[model samples]
Target: MTGSPVTTENVDPLAGVRAPGDPACDVYLTGTVFLDIIFTGLDSAPVRGTESWARGMGSSPGGVANMATALARLGLRTSLAAAFGDDKYGEYCWETLERGEGIDLSLSRTVPGWHSPVTVSMAYEGERTMVSHGHEAPVSEALPGPPPARSCVASLRAGAPQEWIAAAARAGSRVFADTGWDDTGAWDLAALPDLAHCEAFLPNAAEAMRYTRTDNPRAAARALTEIVPLAVVTMGAEGAYAADGRTGETAEVPAILVEALDTTGAGDVFVAGFVTGTLAGWPLGDRLALAGLTAALSVQEFGGSLSAPGWDEVAAWWRRVRDLTPADGRLAASLDRYGFLSGLLPEPAHPWPRRRAVPTLGFRALP
Candidate 1:
């Protein structure tokens, strides 16, 4: 089903702190965007030679677009710099982000000959497998530099550092980084030179443990603080934990229980939530809670960018739980933990219609 356009009446979490010279953008990021086609409701992964039919499917912008859309949905002014191919897929993704999600693409460019990258993701039994294809854009298409912003979120690669990360940090932007899997099996902390400039480093349980040589994810978080001021380790179902090297503070929040439909881009949503709370100067525990809450909400839907919840969803969730009688001690504890959202949420209003990814890129208009 088609969804309504995102409402522009979002409550800015940073309204109270704005000043004349503050950056126009709240977050800046540079990366690649992909046209993601996701299939769900599968009983098992695709067999080697057997045909499998999925009960559900959707299409939307993926990769860096996932994070950008997440931030924008949360009311942050997000800026993305990337290369989009001059193809139908590219056109669709551009409009989806620039108009649909209200993300700024001033630093992005359209390559004449390149085609948009594509990924086919299949979800089954709470796990997903993906296959992707695309040619790299020419080095000449790289972003000239990052714009001034309150913060930047970057996906860090082990040995290949983006000069823009350092540039953004030098421009007084607080950088938060998350890393992909280490394909080379090095897991060497020294390989990530860009971590030196980051204000925070977020990695999953496996990545953190491997990089820090620690047996426990929490220990890995503490070990990483020696490299960055703040380290957050995300344990999928267990929730997330954080350690602050500077303040000697730590916080852990349990994951909100939900049946996940598709896990695509859930991690990106988590980072976006954490960045939102940090920019708003919320407490450490509050930041972790917001991150986990947003991620939890995203997994209950399909696709990535489109599944990210806006302020209206957060408010709806708060109201729902508060109005319900505590069915269990866990439910009551969750309410108490997220109580801070009562003041931060916008005034009650009609909930915005949720957006979902579509199976097709185009449809005919009624005559």
Candidate 2:
């Protein structure tokens, strides 16, 4: 029997929408651009000085590529600003994201004689370890201009300069910021000023704890509220914590669990979903739930940027259980809660093409 028609009762009417003349793009992201070589299917970490083998290997643009592609897959008109080397690797990355994923890279440049950054990631037991090379220098401060949109995504790490944030704010753009994993544990307090300029500060639970000098994720999120007007701390598997400085409200959402194959870009996908919900003016709880589901779906496949689900996948999910009985329990309950799914549009005609040799993992080396 076929599933029943989906219902829209209790769904937020404004779950996803772009305001008229809001921005040139839905989300503008700026950060490092790297060619990612990902290897998977390892049962354990490599032994000291020993050779190890991997079952799967795929190459794709890493770093901000993950966020840019995810945003586009979610039907957001996305843009990226970064420096790329005038090398074959860079060309591959540019074409994959720009042509294959429909991302605007007009603000990104290709530097002559510079080799693009490359990262080799090894995935094992739901965790990943990456070794990278060729990051010679940061994208020059002059390279990235003011965000050309009303909403932008930024990284708080050293690589992402703060000048763009300042310029974007002056232009009345909303900035959403996230940070990188700190290997040194210094947890630089200086980054706080840059974060202050963001409309929302989203950091993982560990990063938030260290940055706020608190052990509890909720407490850390609360402390961040004192800085940015909105704060969200993502806790892998457990869920997410959020604090709204404007309404003096707080919320926690449970993670959506699924069989995870590779969690490479789950966080970035989560950010895309959260941004989608936020732009739609969904309630904080709805935003978190949507983000959690997006991340959950990403881990079900291989590759990083390529694994991101599009509107088609989301629509299929809704259709699968549209007619299921409430007695169907958790899945049914979640689908009902996300009744806003009814508003989702199908994948556009001539929506970016996918490379066949590797299927959905859009990786094409420059010939």
Candidate 3:
């Protein structure tokens, strides 16, 4: 990734070439970062005449910014390319993106407004209902060019300039676009022909199925390949499925073992983990395992990015989970080898590393 605090003479993106011997290690993460200023106003689990509730405030991030934050925290070289207003909210998002050790914002653009792109997540019985207002619009700012030579995962602004996605594809960077789950309207998936340039197309079951115009999710996954090279359909508890090309084989990967909380950015978190693992040369099963575990860990917390586990922690957690499940022995050995190379493991444990959080039914964490 381009924004890691660590830089190498061989790894410069401007070189239009990846440093030698780091093929599995090259990546650049770019997208939006925003403020998720939360206000706790709703009851924990509204019941009959449950009018009494508490009030508090928490500030985290929302949208792609939060997802990028999670990726950076996991120690990838990340470049955030979204535009923000030159005001407080934009400033807030900018500072948050730069707050983490491995994130860089040189590619971030600023518009002429005080409002930033943000969402208000209202907690309701451990889940969130968002009331969002974007004071900063995407049209008012300029986005930097897509990275050259390095690999990338675009947040897939369905309505944004298709040129950006195309440029990324032309550059040798693989695309993994994320949608905000809003109706596409005029910005339908059909408009983004650049999706064919992406190595993997990830869409939630509802979104993918809708885009493909089919209720049978497996068929939808297959149909998506007619447009893109490959597709991964994320189904919440049923886990996720993958297929490639027009007639590629599909496989089912089971969900990781974990108690659920709020599955806010579970999809985005899955992309980050899977893409990171793929760049590291992990096999299909391991990539799916990483995605599944990351998504599972994501729901056990309050907000989007903050809920994601760091890479080492996730790898450690994967190891612990691998022991309890009857997974392929090769995956266990491969994870172990990668761990040793990355200095990630000091022996291993059977249970995944667990993170616990208190749940509130109706309140947003302030950003």
Q: Which candidate number would show the highest TM-score if scored against the true structure?
A: 1
Q: Model 2: residues >4 Å from true position, as ranges?
A: 1-20, 137-142, 158-161, 188-190, 323-329, 345-367
Cα lDDT of model 1 by residue, 1-367, tens digit: 9955433356788877889999999999989999999999999999998999999888999999999999999999999999998999999999989998899999999998899999999999999999999999988776768888999999999889888899999999999999999999999999999999999999999999999889999999999999999999999999999999999999999999988999999999999999999999999999999999999989988898868988878887777777767774555667789999888775445543354667877577799
lDDT of 3: 0.63
Give the per-residue lDDT of model 3 (tens digit) for 104-207. Answer: 66777777644666676666665667777765455646676765534677656565556676777776777777555645455367666667678888887888
Cα distance off (Å), candidate 1, residue 71? 0.5
Candidate with better lDDT, 1 vs 3: 1
Candidate 3 regions with alpha-carbon error over 4 angstroms = 1-18, 21-26, 29-31, 39-57, 85-89, 110-113, 137-140, 157-161, 180-189, 315-367
Local distance difference test scores for all models: 0.90, 0.77, 0.63
Candidate 2 RMSD to the correct structure: 5.6
In candidate 2, residue 154 scores what lDDT?
82
Q: Local error of candidate 2 at 42, Å?
A: 1.3
For candidate 1, what is the lDDT?
0.90
Ranking by lDDT: 1, 2, 3
